[model samples]
Target: MDMKLEVVILPVSDVDRAKDFYAGRLGWRLDADFPIEDGYRIVQVTPPGSACSVIFGEGLTGQQAGTLHGLQLTVTDIVKAQEELASCGVEVSGPFRDETGAFHHAGDARRVPGAHPERASYGTFAAFEDPDGNAWFLQEVTERAPGR
Candidate 1:
């Protein structure tokens, strides 16, 4: 048996605003915008080179908008990715990493400026949020761990 992740449904306050942020600002591919009725709708978009998609709109999930966090996206170049997002008007923060010389540490850990030592894959990170404050992280992964 196999289960493959396909989409994430995000609760958003304004459907058009969320749609604009994801599809217009982030440059994600707008897969659909279907209004099933006067009060229900579905909007879907997929990030570049990502198999998973994001869905948001009216009458969807009951969770509060902007409540989601810690969602991560893997990229080959952290700086380049941040630059792209910044250019798109997304308020991006970081290219930071835990100074522990290993995996990330707990809250308030010492995060030295810039990318990780030797630019190790999966060590460097940056963050941004959607219009609804749904946070997303960008992890620089030049090489993937075995079986990932």
Candidate 2:
């Protein structure tokens, strides 16, 4: 039995604003945006080349907006990804690496200034946030680890 992760629910304060950030600013593909009934709506967006999608809107999740973190996306080039996001008017912070190799990323204490010395796969990363402050990390993964 193969179970696949399909979608992640995002708690957002405003539906249109979040839509603009995800679909307009970040350039993710807008899969759906439908109002179910009164005070209820659902919007789905998928990052390019990703199998999983993200859903956000009204009356869906109990989690507070701007409180979710640790959502990550994989990229082949950290620098390029950061540049692309900055070009899209998104505030990006990185091209940095974990210095201790322990991945302790609670704050900036364990973070180094730049990418890994050898540009190692999964060694470097970048980050950005949505309009609702949902944090997303861009991990540089040049090659898949053992069967992906």
Candidate 3:
């Protein structure tokens, strides 16, 4: 059996605000947005060149508005991604490097304590949160130098 992860569901209070944040601020492509019934809406978005997409809508199963947590999105360059998000008025947390390489946050300026350096073999990583308090991470990794 071949199985693949396809979509992730995010909970939000307002669909329009979430749409603007993911699409307008973060630059995620709007995949779908429409109403299903009784004024409920369904919205989906995909990050640039990503296989999995995020889904948010009214009345999702076992998901409460503004109750989601710890959804990480990886990026190629942490610094560049942080800069871009900062330019869009999103608060970026850190670029701190210790024995465990470097890590940061996207929204708040705080280093996630106890992050080991060996965990970061690539470049570095950071985190941020959307307007709805949805947390995300921007990871940077060094390209493997040819063949070791």
Report every candidate's CA lDDT: 0.88, 0.88, 0.71
lDDT of 1 by residue, 43-143 (tens): 99999999999999989899999998778899999999999999999888788887876655543268666889789888998888888888888889999
Which stretches in model 1 have alpha-carbon errors above 4 Å? 100-110
Clash count, one per candidate: 0, 0, 14
Residue 79, candidate 2: C-alpha displacement in angstroms: 0.8
lDDT of 2 by residue, 54-100 (tens): 99999999999988888889999898888889999999888788877
Per-residue lDDT over 5-31 for candidate 3, one digit per residue giving the tens place of the 0 to 100 score: 789989888888999999988899999
- lDDT for 55 in candidate 2 is 97
- Residue 54, candidate 3: Cα error in Å is 0.6
Those runs of model 2 whose alpha carbons end farther than 4 Å from true positions after fitting are: 102-104
The deviation in Å at residue 51 for candidate 3 is 0.7
Each prediction's TM-score against the native? 0.92, 0.95, 0.76
Candidate 2: TM-score? 0.95
